[model samples]
Target: MKYFFAIIYIITTVAINAQETHKRTLKLMGSRFDITVVANNKTEADTYIDIAVTEISRIEKLISSWDENSQTSKINRNAGIKAVHVDKELFDLIERAIQISKLTDGAFDISYASMDRIWKFDGSVTKMPTPENIKASVAKVGYQHIILDKEKQTVFLKIKGMKIGFGAIGKGYAADKAKQLLKQKGVQAGIINASGDMNTWGTQTNGDQWKVGITNPMNKNNVFALLPISERAVVTSGNYEKYIMINGKRYSHIIDPRTGYPSSGIVSVSVFAPSAELADALATSVFVMGKDVGLNFINQLKGIECIIVDEKGKIVHSTNIDIQDKLKNE
Candidate 1:
C-alpha cells in the first residue's frame, strides 16, 4: 500500500483563448492533488476547483483508515467481531475493489493493509528478511476473507487481525468523484490529478486533447513520450523513487501482497483506462505481476492499455498502445 510519486507530467502552455485554464495545487488524502478547470473567468474556475477540493476532502473522511472516526476505521476495528454497516458509496467502492482483486487473482488486494511491515525500504536493514518471517507477514492479507453483504450494507473481515486500506485506489476514486461532480455542474473540461492518478474529461480550452508526458523510469528527469488523452484516466506506478539495493539487486517498495516481498524485475507501470480508480489499481497490479505476465494481462482487457519499464530499462507496451510512434526522446 505504499504510494508512489507522480510519474506523469502535465504538458501545458499559456492559454491564448478567452476561456482560460485555471489550476490549484493542494494536499488531499495525504497526497498532492492538482485540479484544473476550463472556465470563462478566474472566479468561475476557482469556484469549480473549490468544489473539487470539497468533494475530495469528503471522500477522504469517509475512506481514510488513519481517521479513527472514519467508517473504514470502524470496519477495521470490528474485524472478526461483527459486520459493520457502511454507507452505500463505501460499500460499492469496497465491492469494486474486491472484484478487481478477483480479476487480478489476488494480485491487487485492499486487504494488503493487514500485511506486516517486515521489509523496510528505508535502508535501515542491510539484509533481506527471513523466508518464514516474509511468509508470515502476509498471513492476514487475503481479499477472500473480506465478506460483504449487499442487502445489509455491511463489511466484515473474517480474520481478527485482518484490515483493509485504500492507499492505492482512494486518490483515484477521489479524482473520479471530483471529475464527475464538476462535469455535472456544467464544467466542460478539466483534469483531476491526484498525485499520478489522473483523470481527464473533454479537451483543453483550445480544443486540443490534453497531453501527458510519461517519465522514463531509468531517468526520472527525462520524459520519453507524450500521449494525447481525452475523456480518460492514466496512472503511473514506479519503483525508481523508493527502493533499496540488496545484494546488488534493487527491491521496489511496492510489495506483492500475496508473497509478502517487495516486487522486482519491473521498475514502472503505466495504465490508461476509463477511470482513475481502475487505472490506479491496475498500475499497481502490473508492477506486482511483473513485465511479461502484466503486459499479457493488460493486452487481454479491452480499452485498457499499459506501458511497462523493466529492471533493465526496456520499455514494453500493450497491443493497443505504441509508444514508439509518440516518443519524444525528451
Candidate 2:
C-alpha cells in the first residue's frame, strides 16, 4: 500500500510537469494560418486547431460575398426582388458590422465594396480625380442599405450592385471562433493567428506566458514589441504593408466610406480586444477614423485598447495600452 501511494504521488508529479506542444499550419481562404497549443499531448493540440479551421471553412462557404454560391452572394443577387435566408452566423456578423458603422459614424462600413474603384493607387494613377468622380464613388456606400429580417433570418441589399463583404474582418472572426472552439474542446493553451489578427490563451509549455511580436510598420523584418499576453487578441492594420506609392505619396487600400477616399494622418492601427474578430474590425475602423476620434472611440468601449502610429512614427495609445519595446534594428 505504501508503494502504491508513492507511485501515485510520482504519477501526479509527472503529470504536473509534463506538457506537450502541437502546431498545425495550413493555407485556406488565400491566407496563411499558424495555430499552436500546449496540451497534454501533440495530437490534442492539433485536433483543437483543426476543429477551429473546419469551423472557419464552414463559415467561409456560407458567408463569403466573393463566392457566388454563398448565402451572402445570393442576397446580393436577389437585391430588390426577395429577401434571402442566411446562416445565423452570417446574419450576426452583418449586424455587428452595421453597429460598428454606426458607432464609428460610418467609418466602418461593409458596403464600401459597392463603391467604384476610381482612386487607384497603381503606378498608372496620375492627377487627382475630379470632384464628381469622388462623389460618385460613395453613392452606394451606406450601412442603412443593408436590410436584415430578424424573424426570418434573411438579408436584403436595398440597392442593386450594392454588396457586402468580410475582407477586413473575416480573418479576425475566424480567429475568435477558433479560440472559442479551442476552449470548448478542452484546450488550455493555444493561439490562432489568422494573418495579422491573432488571439491567444493560457501559458506556454515552459510555464511562461505567450509572447506576441508586433510587426514594425517602418521595418519590414522587425517587431515593435514582445507582448506577454493571454486571453487577448491583437490586430494590426497598416498602409505601409500594402499601399502603393505615387508622386511621393502613399495610398492605402483601406478606404474611408464616409469620405470615399483613402485614410490619411494615421499610418498603422493596432487594437487589442477580447476576441480577434472585434479587434480586427475595430482596427480598420480606427485606421480610417484617424487618431483622435478613433482612440476616443476605442477607449470608451470596455476591454478595447488601441495604438495609433502616424506617418512620423509618433504613437498615440488608448487608456490601457502597452508598447514594451521598440523594434530592433529599425
Candidate 3:
C-alpha cells in the first residue's frame, strides 16, 4: 500500500510538470512577438525560442523594403531602369504575392508602396480628396505593372517609381518560417505571434487546442468570440487602433491601393488558413473588399475562413467557421 501511494504521487507530479508552458516576449520586425511553447524544461523552451527569433530577423532583412541594402530595396531602386536579379527565396515570395493579387482582383497589392499618400486618415483631414487627386494617387500602384522575369530570375517595375513592399504579408511570412523551423528542430508545439499575426502548431500542455479570441472592435477590452485552432494560422486586421473621425464618419488607416480612399464599412477582419502569410494578406484584402464581398470570397476557399465585424458592431463569420462565445459560457 505504501509503494502504491508513492507511485501515484510521482505520476501526478510528472504530469503537472509536463503541462508547464514557457513563454518569451520581445520586439521583432517592428512588432511585439509573443512566443510560447510547451516544454519539459526552461532550457529546451529557450533554445527553441531563440531559433525562432533568429529566423524572423533573417526574413526581415531579406524582404524589408525600408532597408536600403535589402534585396527588395534594390528591386525598388532599379524600378523601370533595369530588372534586378534576386535569390530564389525572394523570387518565389514575390510570385506568390502576385498570385494573391490576382485572386483578390488587385485588392491585395504589394505595389502599394508607390501609391501617393494624398489621403490622410489623421484627425486633421476635414474633407475628402478630389476625384482627380484620388485617381492620380493610385496611378503608379498596380500589381499588373510589377514585372517578374522568371527565366532571368529578376524583378522589374514597369513604371520608374513603381515599387513593391511586403508590409501586409511580411510578418506572417516570418511567423510561418519560424514555426516551420521550430518544427524541424523537433519542437512539438509552439506559437509565433507577430503583433496579431499568430500561427500555432501542436496542442497545449493540458492536451487541448489553442483558443484565440477575436477582439470586439467596439469594446476593445472585450472579445466577441473565441476560436479553437490547431496547426493553423489566424490573423486579424482592424482599423480601430488607427483611424480618424470626420463629420461623424470613421475612416480606417488601411487604404485601398485600387482607390486612394481609406477602407470603410468594416471595423475588423480575422482570417484562418493553412499559412499565416495567406491569412495576413486576406485579412487586409477583406477589409478593403467590405463585408458582403469579403465573406463571399472567403467562403469559396476550401481551407480558409473569416470573421468580420462591420461598422455597426455586428459580428459575421464565413460559412465554415462557427465562433463560440466564451463570455456566455462563463
Q: Against the unseen true structure, what C-alpha lDDT does each candidate score?
A: 0.90, 0.74, 0.82
By lDDT, the best candidate is 1
lDDT of 3 at 328: 29
lDDT of 2 by residue, 96-179 (tens): 999988887888888877888887655577666788898898888899989989999998888887878788788888888888
TM-score rank, highest first?
Answer: 1, 3, 2
Superposing all C-alpha atoms, what RMSD in Å does each candidate have to the true structure?
A: 1.5, 9.6, 8.9
Give TM-scores for every candidate, taking all chains together and pairing residue i with residue i. Answer: 0.96, 0.88, 0.92
Q: Cα lDDT for residue 135, model 1?
A: 97
Off by over 4 Å in 3: 1-15, 326-330
Which stretches of candidate 2 lie above 4 Å from their native place?
A: 1-17, 220-223, 245-247, 323-330
Residue 174's C-alpha lDDT in candidate 3?
97
- Tell me the tens digit of each residue's lDDT in model 3 across 1-330: 000000000001123645467889898987788888777799988988999999999999999988999999999999989999999999999999999999999899999889888766556778778999989988999989888889999999999998899999998899999999999998888788887788899887767778776666676666667778889998877776677776788888888899878888987778899999999899889988889999999999999999877888887889898677633211
Better of 2 and 3 by lDDT: 3
Error of 3 at 55 (Å): 0.4
After aligning candidate 3 to the native by TM-score, how far in Å is the CA of 223 from where it should be?
Answer: 3.0
